[model samples]
Target: MDCCSPSRRQALLWAGVAAAPLAFAAAEPGAAAAAMPKDALLVTDAEVVTVTDSSVVITWFTGSATQTDRYGAPAPVPADTELLLGEPGNPGSTRTVYHDTAPTAFHHAEVHGLDPGRTYAFTARSAGQDAQQSTLQFPGTGGSSDAPGVFTTLQPPPGRYLFTLALSNDLHMGEQTAGIITGNWPPAFQQDPGLPPYPEVMLEALLDDLRKPDRGAEVLLVAGDLTSEAKPGDVARVRQLLDGWGTLGTDYFVARGNHDRPHVGADYAACTPIPYATDHHDCWGDVFPYPRQTLSVHQVGGLRIVGLDTTTLDAAGGTLDDGQLADLAAELRRDKDRPTLLFGHHPVTYESAVTTAAGPAFDLDQTKARQLEALYHRTPGVFLHHSGHTHRNKRTFMEESQSVEFLEVAATKEYPGGCSLVRVFTGGYQVNFYKTRADLARQWSQRTRGEYYGIWPHYTLGTIADRNHTVVRDLSGLTALRPR
Candidate 1:
């Protein structure tokens, strides 16, 4: 799914509610009371997915009391429910069909026109059943369009620093099997043999860890590959998952990965290369269109954080074409005086020495690398290039060019399935990686942890002081790099 588009999952969610009643009837006797159904199966999986200053989307599932389908349609939803919206005094509603998908069916609603920093309660109901309500709060500061946070009117001192944000990439959301695969040929969508449901579990755990109050990841940057395949429905599903992060009090920014682009059809039988496909128009860009190779400039204390979309080029492999490279050069020149940090999906340099065998074929394109290196040399504050495609833990220094560090993060849905936390102080930065406790990963080990190499601790924290850079190592706090 594209990171910036309204989620189609929201639409599918409401559609699922139409079948909830049939599902409840199929349930065995003496099931949990919370599992009981009224008119629609009770909103079984109500969750807050994504939130912005003026809007938030809530998703939930409804189950049928039994498996019988009153509606004659094929795969008819067992139960039906109406999603009531608006404030308590005046509520608006929409109806949906609910399909029985084992555990339960889902319903999602995107609530808009909300006041930032205010608390709102959402309720779901079926016939004969009282509505189930859940509450969420919006960010206090920042413009509605800016990443979620409390915006401050006060300007920082000449050299003071602001809050820091964390960057992670290569989630490969739906890739569950352990095999050598590419865009040309992908594995079947059967229960990933390694783990029955790797993506779902790993994602839940990763989000849970990032939401911890102490982690302090004000904004979470998911570099790309939110899913293994760029199926339209899969894109919507990933959005539904990421939207859940809003409750954690962090704004999420996503970049498109090669895997996320519309490379396959609904049936996964035909392969449609990039910039093509009659049905999937700009399929990836429209769904998750933040901006191709644009800049997200934000002030944190005294620092200016610039997030770049380096993966805007064609889909043959991860590369930065003439246009994106030129855009980066111009952007750096425009903000040359500010203390800037760059965040993108692909790394200019590979970190783990072990993966060098893959060569540049697995890393950033040569032209793009050269452009970034030149920019770093000319720009004084371009100190860090944070990336995540290699799925390993290693920090590489650009020795040939000006002093800039590349910090490649691990995949959050496979192996460790964790995120990195970075803290920027007045003088330098401190970095730490946290593991995701996704239940799905724990239930299915092979898909998530079987081929895991164990987590790597003693993460490298690069410090840029005096506009000069050097590399140093400390292993005191290193974690496992393999699957747990």
Candidate 2:
């Protein structure tokens, strides 16, 4: 709700940008003209997002409305936006990506036809100002570390053919926390939810996208944190929205999140509590009727997916007691060759530059993470771990384990708002993030780009398939199953 408008530090915002003087100027402190000229309209908060092997997007803000807080969204800029691109240091080779006719602050331009593992240069001119001279670096294996602004592209998947799965998380139904609950941003931003409750509207769009006749996804996977405060109304609301997709427990699968864990609330206490051996659940005991158990297994597309309740009674992070770990270990031992994926709310390991929610509570505790890593070491069938707590798109290849691919999906309800569609090919699997197609989802995503020091959107929304990725896996175990 911290949607305050600010102005100041307009020069500081773009001062240390990665420009090398080809198109943007490097500001020197104490120099009268060298500084960003207080009144000058220069590109600030420029970034590349939604990157893929064939394309990349560049965005920036114009105007003097600077963000003065560490964790809030700023209002849209007061001008139109445009961008220019070309070979680094060569303006003549430049081509225009696109242009905006309307005067809007938050501007983005997607440049297509980029080769994988290649590098090119470009400049973003918006608000009548140029951002740091940047390069369109594609992803490739084993590149020089010394190269500046080099981005690596994911390798192709292992095979081809098969059904796909849709994955999403952190819907945070009924919570007012901005980033924690998508679409609940500051009022000053003036982003209309299009439909009354923005979260519900956005979630509906996500499900709608998954049901598209042409979408390859055959199963729906909700990682966790389905509700904000685990309210009965909120849980019911989420269930109602999900009903649009199909019958629960069959069309889609879910796991528990900290926010959905059992808690003490009079309003949510009416339903009978589900039985838990350790008494660690909240109102969830009575909330969710299907997938009745936190630790449950489901089969889809010939893959065995495990959902766990990592949330402890009071910790923000998750805990895997010795007993639970042992059980998981035993499960893997039973069918070591099954194509398996584990879904939970808190990630095993999450990295974020912004101190949005600081604490070990933000991720799996050290002991649990180590245990999971050790478990992954021997579980070759485990190809992926999908989690949601961080509400950002991050794919970490567990080099040590060399088996599981860990992906942190963006929140479904807010900034960088969208869900990930995973296309499972016999050769390999590819995950592409998509914002809910509703106009409200688009407006909220653009408006909240200023969250977490104005650079928040860059990470949550992901840069160059950073949020979207393709992985090569030993899917021979799945070869026996045909796409249903």
Candidate 3:
């Protein structure tokens, strides 16, 4: 692996970037301030979030050594931010594609006017200093050769455009802290003191982004983990936010995740009790009752969506239960040739790479997953399976179910804060991941990049191909839902 490869930098590193006031003023260009030592600039989490036929968005964080765990202590560094773009091995061809001299903790840049399906190398700079080195050591002056800063733009989806669906999950509304897996060995990340909770900020920003006309999202699907602990208030709040975007069950749909399972607590006393676990209250069920009942299907234009309630009464893993499993089998048998999209909270273990490290806790039970896979093999209409719980972006094709694409998306409440947009067409479809562009949303994402000892990006941000790609298949039968 190269020096700056994510694999080489898997070791823990204690660097954080959080919400802070920009206290430094921009110095005069090409003045004595230009001589600031390169070591003084602390930049981390430099990454490419969105890619298209002609543009890509890059984001990163700038922190100071004074203090980062709280607000007002380590002020935002004042420096010029620049994105250099060029073809690999062509130093003379490199040019500044984007630049901002503003003093800020969070940075976002968009480089436009690029050729489609072409590869390009990039380098992010703050205060005239290369930024990738702070997170991963760069060998010999930080050139982009064999570096993670390389990416190829995606070609547009084949055939005429049909409709678009916003794919997201793991909102974790009402959560107090993030990255608290297992013990304190990995360290947890919390929103800076006095700022609104990070989860709300991210979700609000997400809704706002979807409202933009260019996004062209006719429908939305959240696979699971919609709340922190299935609290009544959190569940209601999530529903309210989503309702503001579009009508529930029509414009958007949701699936139950492990975190949305029933809980035993006085706060949920007024909620409906889980039939299987009488002691626990189904707070999420009381609000989103449709998805909790059983496997359900919805038709949007020409696409068929099947939502599965993967959560068991109070378990961290998931199962479909006997009835839901039977219903699923019957449904697939009934419509074996209809183009279908299946979504749930837990990924099938056979297609999840995280299952190896996180075990069954991160995915559905192995037997249940195999059962679903066998059904998928028999159903030619099932083209995609969307899932959450692993909290990362991954693409896998199982041997038993070669016709379906198993896609796992990153959590919306943390680093790489965004969702995938699937564009359907007559020939096939394309999936592109996009980060929320709001200021607060971008800041929280940069702050949480330090979660898991600053290696969070390595796990959450999948390779460029995984985030953006096109798949060709005949789907001309489905009608396109034009934006109203």
Worst lDDT window (10 residues) for model 2? 1-10
> lDDT of each structure?
0.48, 0.61, 0.75
- Model 2, residue 16: displacement in angstroms? 21
RMSD of each: 17.7, 8.5, 7.1
TM-score of each: 0.53, 0.73, 0.86
Evaluated with TM-score, which candidate comes out highest? 3
Candidate 3 lDDT, tens digit per residue, 1-484? 0011122122222223222233433332222224445554567667777787777887776665433344222334556679999998787888898888766667888877889888898888877766663333222111222247677787876788888899999999999878765434356778877988888999898888888875778899999889998889999999999999999789999998888877787888899887766788888988997646388799998688999998876556777787899999999999899999999988884647343235545478778888888898899989999987778777776664458888888889987888999989998888888899888888788777766655666666776666677788889898888674
Collision count for each candidate, in order: 67, 24, 0
Q: Write the per-residue lDDT of candidate 1 for residues 151-256, one digit (tens) a residue.
A: 1111112222334356677666556554233332212123434654566676776677666654556567777777776666666677888787752222667766
Model 3 deviation from native, Cα RMSD in Å = 7.1
| Cα lDDT, model 1, residue 289 | 53
The true-versus-predicted C-alpha distance at residue 228 of model 3, in Å, is 0.6
Off by over 4 Å in 3: 1-36, 65-75, 133-147, 182-185, 291-293, 351-356
- Per-residue alpha-carbon lDDT of candidate 2 for residues 1-484, written as tens digits (9 for 90 to 100): 1111122232233233313211222232122112335455435656554444566556565533333222233333445556665666566887766776666555656656677655566566654456552223333222222123233444546665577788899887886546321233222233343446667766877887677754546688888889876777888888878876766777778887877766654654565554663333345545465333237677776788887777765545677767677878888888888888888877775342122234344577766787887887787788888888877776665544446777878888787677777777676687777666555565566556545434455436544545656777656546433433
Candidate 2 colliding pairs, count: 24
Off by over 4 Å in 1: 1-164, 182-196, 247-250, 264-280, 291-303, 312-316, 350-354, 400-402, 438-449, 452-484
Most lDDT-accurate candidate: 3
Q: What are the runs in model 2 whose C-alpha is more than 4 Å off?
A: 1-44, 57-90, 97-114, 122-155, 179-195, 208-216, 274-287, 290-293, 321-323, 350-357, 397-399, 434-437, 452-468, 476-484
